[model samples]
Target: MTGTPRPRTVLLTGASGVVGRSILREPTALRLLAATHSAPAPEADGRRIRCDLTADRLGLEKEEYTALAGEVDAVIHSAGLTEWGLPAERYRPINIEGTRRVIEFARHAGATVHFMSTAFVAALAETAPVALSEGNMCRNYISSKWEAERLLRDSGIPHTVFRPTNLVGDSATGWTSKGQIVQLMSDWICRGRAPFLPAHAGIRMDFVPQDLLSKAVLRAIEQDVSEGEFWVTYGAEAMDMDASLRVLAKHAAYLGRDLTIPPVVDPDTLTAEQLAGLRPMVRNYVAVLRDVSEVTRCSGGVLPSSMPELRTRFGVPLVDDATAYLRSLEYASAHLS
Candidate 1:
C-alpha cells in the first residue's frame, strides 16, 4: 500500500481544555504537536511536547524549535489561564509573551496561526449594555487579546482569531456539561443547593457548545479567512435561567417526580442589600450565570467594525431554547450527582 500522506502539523498549546479536546475529535489530515506545561492523561492522537510556557526560556531550546518548526504547518494557541484570581503580570507572560513566542516560531516555521480569545475582552462600561464586537475596547482580558491580535496582524502571517462566548458541552461525550446554568439549576433542584432559585433567572445568557466551537475552528482554517477576529457562538435567543428552570421542573413533574421549583427574581431587579445577603458561594454562582451576550449577524446583532467580517460563517442549528434547556437538563441529570 502507498504510504499515508504526510499529515499537516498543528502546534496547539492547550490540548486538554474543554474546547481544545473537542478539536481533537475532528478528523483532520494533520499531525498535531500538542504542547502543555505538564503531562495530561493519555489521549488518542498527537505527539505531546512538555514545555512550560511561563519558564524563562519557555523550555524550548533552539534545536527543539528548529526541529518542530520544520514539521508544523500551523499553530493553534489554546493554552491560557482563564480564572480571574491571577495578577495581570502573570497573565501577560503566558497570554501575551507566550503568544509572541508562538508567533515568532510560526514566522520561522512558515505556518498559519489560530488564536483562541474570549468574548469578555469586549468589556463594556459595566453601566453600558454589553457592546461586544471584535474591536470594542477591553480593559481586562480583552486588552491582552487585542494586544496579541495587533502583533499577529503586523507579523505578516496568515492567522485567524476566534472570540467565543461561554463554552458548553460534555468534554467526554460531546454533549452538554453540568457546569452550565441549566445544569446548575437542575442541581439546585435535585441536590437542594438552595431553598430558592437565583434572583436573576430571567436574564439572558449566550453560550457556544464545544462541538460547534471545534467545527468552527476547523472551518476557519479550511476557509482561510483573512487574518482578524471572528466571534464563534450561537445566535439562539438567550435563555433566562428562571424561565428555563420552570420548564425543567415541568419536565420532571411530567415524569412523576416530586420537587419544588421556586419562582426566581430577575437579577436586574435585586436591591444591593438583597445581593449582599446572598451566601458567598451563591454570590460566586451569580457572577457566572448573570453575564451574557449575542455576538453575531445571525442574531441580528451588530458585528464590531474593527473585526474583519468573516466571509465564511457557520450558523448554529441548535433546537429552540426550550429544547436546548431540556438537552442541558438531560446532560445535567446524567453527570451531576
Candidate 2:
C-alpha cells in the first residue's frame, strides 16, 4: 500500500483577514508561505512574502515570483478589495486581475489553487435571493468574483472554489478585522437602532465564523476534491439574523448596564432627515439594519442549503451559529469599539 503523501506547502494570501487569520492559528504540517499586502506582520513561523497583488508582477519579477511560487504546493488566494462602495476599476485591479495573477503563478509553479469567493456574487440588486448557492448567477461583487472564478477555471489549474457567507470573529484581538457588514451590524446592536418587527428586522444573513471558514479551506487543501464549487457556511438552519442580533443584545447587556439594544424598527417609521442626522455609529447601524431587512423581506426565508460533500467527503465539522455568534460578540466588545 502507498503511504500518504508528505504534508504539502501552501502560499496563503490575505494573512490577516477574518478567514485567513483563523487558518493561520491552527498547527498544520504543510509548509506555509503566507503573503500579505498589508504592513509587515509580527514575526511568526511561516515563510512571509510581502507583495501587492495589484502590482504588474504582484510586486515580484517573473523569475523571483516564479521561484517563490515553485516553493509552494498550493495557493490560497484570499487577498482582494472587499469594499462594497469601491469603484469597479478599483475592484477590478485587485479582485479580478490579482486573482488572475494567483492563477498564473499557481499554474506556472505547478501548484493547486483555492479561490476565496463570496456568496454575494449570486446577486447585486435587492431582488436577488438571500439563499444563493453554487448554481446561482452572479451580481454585484458576485459578478466580479464570478469573473475571477471563470478565469481560474479556464487557466486549467487544479482549483477549489470557496463561496462563504458573512464572516464573524473578534476584532480587538486582531483575530478578525471588522468588515463593512460587520461594522454596520455592530453599530445597530450597540446603539439600539435595529427594528422590532420580523419584517423590518435585518435579513437572515448566512454567517460562518473564521474558524469554520478556515477549516473548510484547509479541508479543501488536504483532499483532492473535484475541481468545482463549494459553499463554506455554518449551514442553512444556523443563519438566523434576528436570533443572532438577540445574542448581540445579550452581549451588550453584559458589557454595560446602560446599553440596551432595541428590537427591529419599521423602515417606514424613520424619516429620511432623522436617519440622516445620526452619528456615524447610528448611520451604519441603520444602514445595515435597513439593508438586511429589505433584502431578507424580498428574498423570503431560509439560508442556502449546506453542501454535504464538504462533510461526507472531506469530514469538515459543522459549527454552532449561536455559539460562534456570541463568541464573536464577546471578542469584539472586549477588543474593538
Candidate 3:
C-alpha cells in the first residue's frame, strides 16, 4: 500500500511581505522557497529567491527556473499590487497577469497552488451575507482579485483560495509593513482634518489581524488543503464602524489631540464643495465608504460565517477587535505620524 506523501517544499511568493514573514515564523514541517521581488530577502530559516511575479519565468534564470520546477511541491502566491485608486491598467499587469504567471509556474512545477485573494471581492454583491463566502461580484481592485480567482479555478491545478479582509497590524505587537486604509483614516482623524465620515450604526468594518491571516495561510499550506475558497475574515465579529471610531477617538485622546469624533453622515448629503475640500485620498475613501454603506444597508449587515473548522483544527486564536484596533493605532502613531 502507498504511504502518505511526505511534507513538500513550498515556494512562498511575497516572502518579504508582512503575511509572508509571519508565515515564515510558524513552526511547519515543510521547507520554504521564500521569494521576493525587490525587498531584501528575509533572514529566516528558508531559501530566499529574488523573484518578480510579473516577469517571464518569475524573473529567474533558465537554470533557476528549471531547478524550481523540479523541486517545488507547492506555491503560495501572495504577491500583488494592493493599492486602491490606481487605474485598472496599473493593476492588470501585476494583480491579473502576475497571477496568471504564478498559475503558469505552478502548472509547470506540478505544484499545488495557494492563492491569496481579498474579501472585498464580495463587496460588489447586491445582498451581503453576514459572512461572505466564495463566489461573489467584483469591481476595481476587487475586480482584479476576482479575475485572479477565476484564473486559478480554471488553471487545472490543485489550489485553495484565501480571501482575507482588511488586514490590520499584528495581533500582539501591532507591527505592520503596509499602512492600510484604516491607518490613513486614523491619521486624518488625529490631524483634525477629517471631522466627519459617512457611516451608520449598522455598518460593519472587517479588520483581520495580520498574524491571524498569516497563521491561516500557514495552516492551509501545512495541511495541504486544496478545496473550496476560504474566507479569511472575522465575519460577524467584525467591528462596527461606530465602535471602531470610538477606539480611534480614545487613541487620539491619549495622543493629546483634542478633537471631536467624526460624525457619520450620508455621503450624498455632503455638498460637492465639501467633498472637494477633502484631500484626494480622503475623498476616494469617502466614496468607498459610501459604497460599502450602501451594500451593507441593502444586505442587512450579513456576511458569511467565519472558518471555525480551520481555527479549531489549527489552534488559531480568535482576534479581539478592540485590542487589534488599539495595536494598529499605536503602530500607525509610531510609524506613520
Candidate with maximal lDDT: 3
Using Cα atoms with residue i matched to residue i, what is each candidate's TM-score against the true structure? 0.75, 0.81, 0.87
Ten residues in a row with the worst lDDT in model 3?
A: 130-139
lDDT of 1 by residue, 1-337 (tens): 9997775678877876655666776666666677867647244365788766666445788788789888888888888766543456767977888788888888888989998887654454233344544422123455576677777878888888887766666333426422654466455655445545433322344444566566667766655554766775433355555555666677577546766765564545656787688899876555433333222211233222211233236433442445555555566566653
TM-score, candidate number 1: 0.75
Cα lDDT of model 3 overall? 0.76
Per-residue lDDT of 106-168 in model 3, one digit per residue for the tens? 888888888888877665455544433222122467778888998988878899888887778
Query: What is the C-alpha lDDT profile of model 2 across 1-337, one tens digit per residue?
Result: 9998767888888876655666777556666777877754443366788878888667887788878876778988888777653445767888898998887788777888888987554444345654433322222355578789889878888998888777777322324555436544664556555443323444465666666667667776777543767776544565565676677667767767455546456765867787778777666555545554544344443334445666676666655667666677666666666
Q: Which whole-number lDDT from 0 to 100 does residue 243 have in model 3?
A: 74
**Model 1, which residues run further than 4 Å from truth?**
1-5, 39-41, 124-139, 170-186, 189-203, 223-228, 236-243, 250-269, 291-325
lDDT scores for all predictions? 0.60, 0.66, 0.76
State the displacement of the C-alpha of residue 50, model 2, in Å, after optimal TM-score superposition. Answer: 1.9
Name the lDDT value of residue 89 in candidate 2. 71
Off by over 4 Å in 3: 1-7, 125-138, 279-285, 288-305
